[model samples]
Structures are given as structure tokens and as C-alpha cells.
Target chain A: MSAQDILVLAEVNQDAVADITFELLGGARELAGATGGQVVAVLLGHDVAKHAESLSAADRLIVIDDEQLADFSPAPYLAVLESLVGSEGPRAVLAGSTTIGLDVAPMLGAKLNAPVVNACQQVAVEGDLLKITAAICGGKVLAEVEVSASPAVLLILPGSFRPTEETGAATVESRPSPVELHRGAVTFEKMILPAPGDVDITQQDVLVAVGRGIQQEDNMKVAEELAAVLGGELAASRPIIDQGWLPTTRQVGKSGMIVKPKCFIALGVSGAPEHVEGMKDSELIIAVNTDPGAPIFDVADYGVVADLLDVAPALTEAIK
Target chain B: MNIAVVVRQVPDLVEPLEIDASGAALDVDEVEFLINETDDHALEQALLLKESGGGSITVVAIDFGQVDDVLYTAAAKGADRIVKIPYDDDDRPPRPAEAAAMIAEAVKDIDAELVLVGSSAHDELEGVLAPLLALKLELPYLGVIRGVKPGEGGSVTAFKEFPGAAMAQMNVKLPAVLGILAADQPPRYVPVSRIRAAMKSTEFEEKETAAAVPEPNVTVLRMHHPEPSGRAEMLTGSEDEVAARLAEILKEKGVVQ
Candidate 1:
């Protein structure tokens, strides 16, 4: 009930607590140290109490179980969060910069008349205010922002914070729904999964990834040849997947698979933040693009400022 | 059904961006502006819906960053009406909250059954506008929708994307807001002659509304391009030389052995 507390909105997927929720808990723990308040994790779902046992980084866990929250609909989630935030006033609320978090933050900001910051890569508490560095313009630029208002809603990008190693016994409280629930205008019908039986890029040891600069479908043969020479698989950025040159399963990005292969070779990939977040943790990274200023070079261990179209075939021939 | 689509003009990212003197934003004068990619998809979705279900699309935009060209192009692609909210401030682009407030003010009287906007933009990667606009109008919102089709009895079926490439088919009632990630088909390529014809015949309906900018909650302290971390060892040479070096490196790492 302390105003200095930092509140974390727990996100659940497939009836289990999501990894991003743990990331949020880790971030909240750090912010709570400065605010001098306990870290409070609010879990909202149907039959979610069992998931709270893993949120050890939080000092307190609050679970709200209700039938209205069985599936994530915007209206009911907003209603519950609004009432909870109003009653349990905290210095700031942290959520993932994810599909669900992006959908929820703005609505909650409007409902509470609070300021919302998104795409936060780093956050710190300065005296009574908060300082955040947000990655915007698709990771080409970074903006440092100051939150001068209390009760701010901050949406953190995934992979910005590591999960906390501290294992503490958090006191749990099961609370009832604070507001009446009704069927909203939006109804979730069913979940659709990606098609199976494709090469799982996440399980690969060596990956050759292409991007829009690969020219067209014809150029894909070059990358495939290189991957074959290396005995590896082929992956692509979002544009390649969107253009249907590669299937969604071969896409490596925020919306696709997060891969950490032993050897990652990126061709013609400009390395937008969304794409970089998926493969930045590879054991060894190599990138080749025509543009010298491509952001992919920032994370790549080796960079070649040349056309991947020329390098791919030549490298494949050399390897063969 | 009457649908309203919000089209925005953003800096073309193909060109390298130069940081402004203030170190807090882009140097707008040097960059070229184009219709945002997803917003173009939103316009295309609106057109597809009109063709299939017999509806009218009223394209709306704030008068910023060559938005007139986008409106004209929408008209060329079969938009029924063009609505422009008067915004002359060019020193900086409107924040998400302010833009959503202004858009809500402009579109409230149109009585549109559905409002479609791009799910995210390059400048504001957070994609907060659609939900903020929905809250301001007291309408239910669904963001990150890939494809949408008209459903039975004033409802639309939307395929909303989740993390890990999962999707959910959602049934949304009329008078809702959708943040479109992509439309069913790619945006049609309207020829130059069609745009010229639209320019001659299309009349923009100017809607003047007092800008109600909410109090600033977040203020930019600084902005800059990411400094190279020196992690990448630049291999500078001709194509053959670089390819030879890459082959050697791969062999050393046992990747191409």
C-alpha cells in the first residue's frame, strides 16, 4: 500500500507465467530499491495462483482470479487494472513492450490520466523523478526521457533486463475482482499457431539469415548455397517473411523466433532493433551489407561493408 | 459501413537520418517524408472492405509532413472523402497523446462504424496512438491486427498477432478501433495519372478544431544515434578479399570445415 512501491503487471501465456513477466519483476526490483518500497507483482488470470510461486523477485504478489479474465480481452483487463491501480497507488507501473502490453498501456494511461512511456531500454530513478532511455525510430535513435509525473506507466522492451537471481519468499495475497465484469465489444475466438514441420531456427548451431537487400527470390539461392556449404539452416528478417520469400518459421525477429545459434551470419540485414533483439545473443556474429551505417554492425563481431549478393556466392564457392 | 482511416507521413527511413542540433530529434529539413508503410496498409484494408461489403471510406489526417499527398493518393485509390485536421505546427511532430486527442476530435462526428490506423510507426515505435484514440472515443480497441474481414451483423473478424508469431481470431462489434499491422493484400500501386486526376477532382474537407494537448507527462532530455560499440571488426577490402577473409574466419571457427 505504499505510494513508493513499483507495481509489475504479470503477463501469462498458455496458463503459465511468461518469461517477460520475470523480466519485469527483475526490473521492478531494481526500481523499488531507489523508491524504498516493496516490489508488488499483480497477476490477473483464471487459475493463476500456481504461477505466482516462480515470481521470487517480487516482495509481494497479488493474484486476481475471475472468470472475466479467462482470455485476454482489452475491456475487462483495463477495468481490473484501472481499479487495482487506483486503490494500490504506486510510483510507477511496469509492463512489457509486447503485443499485450502495447495494447494495455495506452488504455490504462487514458483511464488513469497517467503518462505512459514505451520502448524503454533503460530506466533509473533520479531523486523523486524517473529517467528512461527509449529506443525509437526502429532503433536508429535513442531518446532520453524524464518522467515528471507520479504513477507513470512504463513499457519495457524485452531483453533489456536480465532475470533476477534472488530467490525470496514473496508473501502472496489472493484478491477478488475489484470491478463488475461484462462481455465487451471484443471477443477472442481461438488461438492460431504457426505451421509446423519447418526447420527450427532456434535449435540450429549455424544460421545464415537474409534481409530485404537480398534483392529477390532468386538471390535466396545464394544464401541457401552458403548455408549448405556451412551445413546450417536459413533464416530471414521480417521483410523476407512478409514478402513470402521465407515462411514465418524461418523469420528471426520480435514477431518471430528468438535464436541464439553458435554461428550467425547476417546478409543484407540492416539490423533493425526488432530483428537485432532476436539474434544479438549468438555466440559469434557476422554481418555483410552494402550500407556502412547499418545498425547490425553494432552487435556483429565481424562486419563487411560490401554487397551480400557478391559475398554470399563467393564465400560459398570458397567454402565448397 | 462507414470506415475512417488515419494516414500519417513519416520520414523515409531508406535515407540515413541526421540528428538535429538540439540532439533531441531528427533533422526534419533534410529528410523526405512518405506515407507510413502500415498506414498505407490501413488505407488498402479500408479499400478492400469497401469493395467487398459496399462501404465508404473517409480518409483523415492531421495537416503535417506532406499529408496532403497521402490524402490525394487515398482518393486516387477510391476513398470517398478526404478530411484534414488543421495542424500547422511544424517545429516538431505531435506526440501520441496529442495526435490521438486531435484525431478523436476530428472523427467523432463522422459516425464511422470502424476506425483503422497503423499499429506502429517508425518514429514512435511504441504504437500507442490507436489505443489512446480508442480510449478517448470510449471504443474497444484491438492492436497489431494482420488481416480483417467483415463478419455477420455489424461485426468484423480480425486476426490479432501475439508474441512468438501466434494469432487470435477476434470478433469485434461495430464502432471499434483497429490497429492494422497489415492488410489482406499488398497496397495497390496507383499510377501517376490517377493521382493527377485525383488532385484535380478531390476536394479536401478542412475540419478546424482547437488543439487540446494534454499536459506533458514525459519530456525528452536528449536523443542521439547509437554509438558503435567497437564490437564488430571491420574487414575492409574488395569483394574477393573480404570473401577470402570470411572463409578463413569460418574455417578457423570450424563452421565451414
Candidate 2:
């Protein structure tokens, strides 16, 4: 417990550590180098200590094992974090900007009176200042910021850093909950997994994704035709699925599936950062939209500034 | 049950955004403000909860952009009270922590059972308000909630989403903050006539709080548009010409017959 340590909060999924945990560990290692601090990983949950064997990227692993942490409840988690962050004044605390991070980071910042930078993509310590680049406005803009406060709480976006390849062992330290864990106002009931037996968009080589420009449910047929003609599966952005025009399994974005198809055909998609996070790794991307300034064009391999309604039918006919 | 819903306006992304002279913010004069999409969902969820569970909806907002019109629309959609905090600083709103503190001062006396805010806003994707405000109010917090149903014994069954489409049914007790991702139903469309009526009939409750501008924890060194990767080969010309070009490229990639 020292100021010369960088702390990382490891997120758990189905009793195992999530990939974002390792990504944060990797990011923490870089910051640790700049601050000349040891990388410490904080794991909280029941029986989660077994998963700590894979987190060797950190210099030390602190496991707060408790039955109350069997599932994520914000109050207990926040309480435990306040104790830890207060005891060990780390140079910075890093967490993934996912559900858990977004839920707890701000509260933790308020509790500790520390600065918190969200959607953080890059962190650099220049001279005596800690600088960060955060993606705001749905990835439409990037802002470079400097944090003048000590022990900054940084919520890092997933996929921003590569997972560490180092495989050394970490010093494991087991500790009990600092505060008495009580059943608070929040209780975790059960997990709801997406239904199976749908066309898995993640496995498909070619995907035709539609967005809000599809407009109505009836217009989905045009995108489906384009998908069929391309020998591909039909996927959609969040808006289409939110309208219940497609199953949740067919949705792509930060909250939905992360896909890497060989050929991605985006129709009328404005390409918000969340949606772009899913398909940016596709081998080739073709975007069709009426707006020439749509962010989709920035990531597309081929961009067509035209109405997708017209382009869809014409592409279906042209392919046939 | 008494519910407090927070709504704010963000820059409409339909048009391109320009950088300001300061190089650290957007050119707000050239931007148009629209009610954040998720905040609209938050308002809708509040309205739905009120409709089903029997409650009063109080819509609160920071005075920025054309928020008066948004408050009127909420009134037309069944909000019982409207509270507007007077703020006329730069176009950029307060940071989440300061904003949360400011809002906490306004709503702390309401003694509401639930505080619903959008999970994230287009202008500020961090979605920190709910949790920060929860910390201030000493309440539990949940974010990325898709649907919320009033549960037995002063709790609500919140359908909260994890990453990768996984969801969980959480029993969040009353006096909690929920960052709503979407409502069970789409936001209702109030007729223009109804809005005009609301404008004429509705009175706003003003809350005066000390707007001490704290030094920003995070100082923006620069703000700029994301640089295009330049990998995109824009297919220009008429729609037919682009479609033909796309087909040939798809064929070359061996992705189509």
C-alpha cells in the first residue's frame, strides 16, 4: 500500500476474469513505467482468487474475496474500493469503461475527491504532468487533457490497449473486506443470456448491417435482400435492434456483439463510436449513406455517398 | 413513488462539428442542440413508470441550449413538475462531478424514490451523473439499464445490460439512481398543440444554487476531429456507378458469386 503503485480493478465474468481486465493490466503497466510504480491488480468476488494466476502483468495482486461479492452490487463494491483507494494512495487507478467502470468510477471519484477521466484512450506522463487523450462526442472528437491531481481515477475504454504478453507470476495477497458487507438496496437476480440458434454474425464472413436510415421495419427487407445477394448474413446497428426489427443477437456495437467479418456492408449507418468499435476490424468495409460527412466513411474501405435505399437494390441487381 | 428525471441537450451530430478558436472545445455557435437521445429515453422511462406504478414525475435540467422547450415537452408528456437550474456559462456544460453536485443540491429535498438519468449523452459519453449523484445522495446506482419494472417491497427489477448483450435482472431498492439505456416503449409524440398548451399552462420551479466554477480536474490541451485513416476508397459518381463498382470489388474479394 503505497503511492508508488498503479492499481487496476479486474472485472470478472462467469467466475473468470474478463479480457478487459488484462487490457487494463497492460495499460497499467505502461503508466507504471512512467510513474516508476509497481502495477497492482485488485480482484473482488467470491472464489475469484483462482483466476489471479493469469494476471501476471501486475507486480502484485490483491484479492478481496467475499461471499457478498458473488455478483456485482454497486454499494458493496464502492465501499470496498473506497477503503482500498484510501489506504493505498496509488499514482492512478485504471478500470475499463464498461458497465462496471461507468457505474463505480464516478462514485469512487466523488468519494475520494479524486479526478476521474472517462473514455480514456491514451495516457502519457510528460515531464511532471499526466496527460490523457479521451474520445468524447461518440468518437467524433478526441480531446487531449492533463490531470493535475494526484491518484487520478482513469476509466479506460476497452480495445484501447493490447493485452500484455508477459507471463511472469504475481505476488498474491489475500485480504478480507475492509467494511462489513451487507445486502444493500441493490441485489443481483440472474443473468439473461442471448438466445441461441440465430445466424451468428460474428462467424459470418460477409455481413450487411443496417442502421436508423432503414427507417421503418418494412425497409429491412431491402437490407436483407442485399445480404442474401451477397451470400451473407443480416446484422444491424443498435437502433434497428432497439426498435425490435431484429433480434438482439443480430445487433452490433459496444453493448452487443463485436464482429470481424471479411466484408462488412454498412447501409445508412452513421457509424457512432460504439458501432465502429464492433466492426472496425473487418477485412473490408463498404458504407452507403446519403451524408458525405458520416463517421462511417472514416473507417470504410469503400464509401458511397448516396441513398442506401437506392444503393441496396442496385447492388443486389448488379451482383445478380 | 416520486421520480426525478434529468434531461439535457447535446450537439446534434447530423451536421459536422467545427473546432473553436480555443482549440479545446467545439464551436458552439455553429452547432445545434438536440435533446440527447438516451435522455429522451430516460424521460420516456420516467413517464412509463409513472403511468404504470402511480407516481409523479419531476423533470430537472440545467439551463442550457433550448432546454425550456424540452421541459415543456416533458410537461406535455405528463411530468408533474419542472425544475430548471440557472446556468449561463460557456456553451460547454459543467463537468460531471460539478454538474452532479449542482443537481444534487436541487433534488436532495425531493425525497424521491428513484432518480433516472440517461446512461450516456452524445456530448459526454462517460455517463457519470447517475453514480456521482448517487454517491452524493448516498444511494445505490445502476447503469446501462434497458427496462425497469417496479418490484415488490420497495424495490425495482432493473434489466441492466452488461457488455456483449448480456443482461441481468437486478433488484434495486428504492431511492436509487438508474442510468437508463432505453425505455420499454419509445418516447411518445406529443402534438404541437399540446406543447403549446403546456407552454402556456406549465410553471417552472426555480432552484438557486451556488455555481462556484471549480478548476477543472482535467484540462483539455486540445480538441480535434478524429483523423480519417485514409483507408477508404470513396466510390463517387451516380448511385448506379458506385453500385457497379462495389459489385466488382466484392467479386474480387471472393465474398460473392
Candidate 3:
């Protein structure tokens, strides 16, 4: 009814903002530019105002700060977001397709009876229609979807949108969450961290990953050496993790972490869709597999048909 | 406790999917199909919960014609009943909404205190079915559930894996739907004897197909292997020479300082 306001739902954990939040803001900026709309970032957390300036790119920043909202509970988070969406009637709501966003986006969409496009790679607004593209069937195909519903909720793939440092003197407003904080039906459990060195790979600019072709667990040192040379993190295919050669957090595939590094070098990795989809957004992909026909080459920017044992050490030495 | 599990026979993960000449759909003829890996996890969780709670387990699948053996395999894995919704030859590939609708309708009659589904289907529809099914069933849905326990008063509590070093426990009222993540647990192997007996003894009741599957609006324009960037120039001579040559290559590729 009113002028379309773009709502960007900010996902926070333990009083820290998620990286994808800024990425979604980048995308919202582009969408707002095209549609003549204002970007309004909705943040819910305890002391949320402390992080308001970081999101100054938004035309308007709405903060719902409550002590009960310190941790991420779907009841409080979803209720606040739902209330904001209802009151503002944003033309579209965008969120990062992370684990938190994935949980909250759909719930918000279902509550509003709106359609949601999840894990979209690209979005374009033409007049009133919004066209979103996402990798489908793993990374073998790309599907372009058009959403016609009003106040559409979209889960955008992280790293797909590059965050720009163009800050504006935007206004920030603090508001009370209309939703009451009911004792959640869910309880808080202990958090289990991934094994040491199995930290966030999505934030890294360069990644060196290994696959089953490396032959044995001990032999993974060659790939690790290469990663060290590149100043990058070590990642792996599913089989590597399944074999216990690498931790599950280092696994790069549909089930594991999805990374969009600046450069991704795969050693002895076949390009399975599950694995490829996770890294397809990497700016430059160099896959070194003995098998020339390995699927990894399908989407790789560069391919080398050679054994990783020879190629990996050589590359590492050369880089050194 | 009564648990319902939804499974689908999808193209084997190890085998590559081939696109048909039309480029519109996968060439199923070349690829072998199996129970989706995540779906297997869901079935295993259901069986585990059933064993723990002393309950019955019903496994439901939308048979898309090529994967009848997968449905029987579910029975071998410990499903008490299997319902197959036959695929309409004329209809398009079953979408998440359609499968969820069929599963919701079938489970309506069955008294299921909990419904479990694979977090994501291996096919194009990954992680879409469970949430859609939860909406259709009007049940609170939990995604990426790694562990489940029977809480007090006929309620189920699950530890869901969240991003960035976080885990959330959701206590759902009875008759809730859960989507099990693929990494939740390893699927148990069924003995050969059980497999053979399941193949012969499993009885499938087919449900009426829904309306003509809507034709997909978007179509793949073409499918082809990506063109290789360039050949790696082999470097020979001393390590110093090799390093120098490699640095030059990286500079040429704009990868180095």
C-alpha cells in the first residue's frame, strides 16, 4: 500500500552480527536502487543499538532490543520479524540463507502466507516483479524463479552478493517488538564446537580442498602443505570427512559448509554436484584430478589432469 | 509413540546424473536410483525412536515409477507399512508441495505422534519438502534435528544444529513433523536376508494421483561441460627457476602480488 520498503532481517548470535547480514544489505541496496524503495534493516537482539551504526547503509534501521532476545530463539526472533513485516508491509524481505535464516525465513513466509525463494544467487527487480536465480540439481543447473506475491520472503545465498563500503548518513530508530516473549517451548542445550581447525571456511578468501583421490589419510599432508603455501584453509569432499581424514566442518558439499572463496584449488577432487554446489561461487576454481573427465572440471575455471601427489607438492613448492 | 517417515528414491549420489537431449530433465535411464541419503537418515531415526519408545513406524514414498525397489528397501530397514503414490506418466516430476500434500493426506488417518522427513531430498527439491509438509500439516517443524528425546507429557524435544557454533533444542507438542539433516547419523545396513524377505513380502498400496503436474515454467536452455581455462605450463629446472616461473604464471593469472 505505502511506498515499498525493503526489509533486511539481521541474524545475530551471542551479540555479534553475522557476515551474511552485510551481504544481504549489499543486495538490498541494489534492489532498492532499481525499485525506488528504501532499505530498512530489522535487527533483534539485546543491546541491538550498539550494532546499529554498522548497518547505516540502510535507509532506516529498526532495532528491537530486549534482554530476552539475547540468544536466538525462534519464538522471539520470528515473532519480532513477523510483527515488523506486518506493520511495515515491505515489498520484499531478504535474509541470508544460513542455518538461522533458513529456519526463520520460511516460518515468517508461512506466517504471512507468502512464497519464499531460498538460497537465491541473483535477484533482479523489474517494475513490480522480482526474478531470482538459484543453483538447482546441485550445481549442474541454474533455475530462474519469478515471484509475484507481495511482501515476498527470500533467503539469499551468502557470498553471492559482494558487500560494498558505500555508507550513507542513514537514520536509525529503536522500536519495541510488538510480540511478547513467551517462554519458548524449546530449551537451550549445550553447544558443540567443531573439532580444532574446523572453523568457518566461508569467510576465507582462498581455500585448498582435498578429495578421496588423495588415496590415504596420511597423504592429506600434501594438500595441507599447499593450503599453507596459499595462506588458505584446508577443506575436503564428503568422502574425506567420512573417512575421518578431515573433520565434518572442513567438508565442502551440499551437507557441509558452502564457501565462496576468491580462489579454490581442489586436489584430487571429483566435481560432484554436492561438492561443486558448495564452491561454485568461488571466483576462480582450479581442480587437479587425475581423471580428465571428473565433474569438478565442469564448473572449474581451470582444470589440470594430473595426480595430486605430484601436482600438489609441486604447486606448494612453486608457491613457496 | 507412533512415528511416520517420508522417503524418496533419488538418483544415486555416487553416479553422475545425465541430462536428456531435451535438457529439460535428468536422463534417468543412465543413473541408478536409491533412497536419498538424508531420507535414509530420517528412516533410521524413525526406527531408532520406534525402538526406544515401543511404537509403530510407517514409511511413505511417492513412487516416481523407476524406484519401486527403494520403497521395499524401507520395509527391510524396519518400516511397518509402505504407501506408494504412483507417478502420473503425464505429470511432471513430483515437486515438494505435491509430495508433502500426499504424505500429509496419507498420515492423516494414521495416528502419528511424530513425523520425520529427510532435511532435503537429493533431487532438485532439497530441504523443501519438510517445511512445506509442516505448513500443510499445521505442525511445528524442526529442521536439522541431530538428536531427539521423548520429553515429559507426550512431548518430543530435539537438538537442532544451527549455524556458527550453536545448537537449539525445540520441544514440540505431540504430532510434530521433523526434517532430519543428512549428517545427523549414519544409516544402518539391513542384513541380506531381511532385504530378500522385504522384496518378496512388502505390499504397497498406491494412492490416487493428484491433478496434472504443472509444467515447469523455466527450462534449461542448454547443458554442456564448462570449457577449460588453459593448460598449466610445466616448469623444469632448479627449484628457484620453477618458483620464478610459477610466480610469473600467478602474476599472469592475476593471483599473486
Best by DockQ: 2
Give the Å shift of residue A164 in candidate 3. Answer: 3.2
Residue A34 Cα positional deviation in candidate 1, in Å, after optimal superposition = 1.2
Candidate 3 lDDT over residue span B67-96, tens digit each: 677777778888888877766553345766
Off by over 4 Å in 1: A215-219, B125-127
Q: Output the worst ten-in-a-row residue range by lDDT, candidate 1 chain A.
A: A239-248
RMSD of each: 1.9, 1.9, 5.6
| C-alpha lDDT of residue A96 in model 3 | 75
lDDT of 2 by residue, A1-26 (tens): 66767899999876667878989888
Candidate 3 scores a C-alpha RMSD against the true structure in Å of: 5.6
Against the true structure, candidate 1 has what lDDT? 0.87
Cα deviation in Å at residue B123, candidate 2? 2.1
Compared with the true structure, what per-residue lDDT tens digits does model 3 show for residues A196-276? Answer: 665689888889999878988789899888788777889998657645566667878654777898888888887765577
User: Which pairs clash in model 2?
Assistant: none
Of 1 and 3, the candidate ranking higher by lDDT: 1
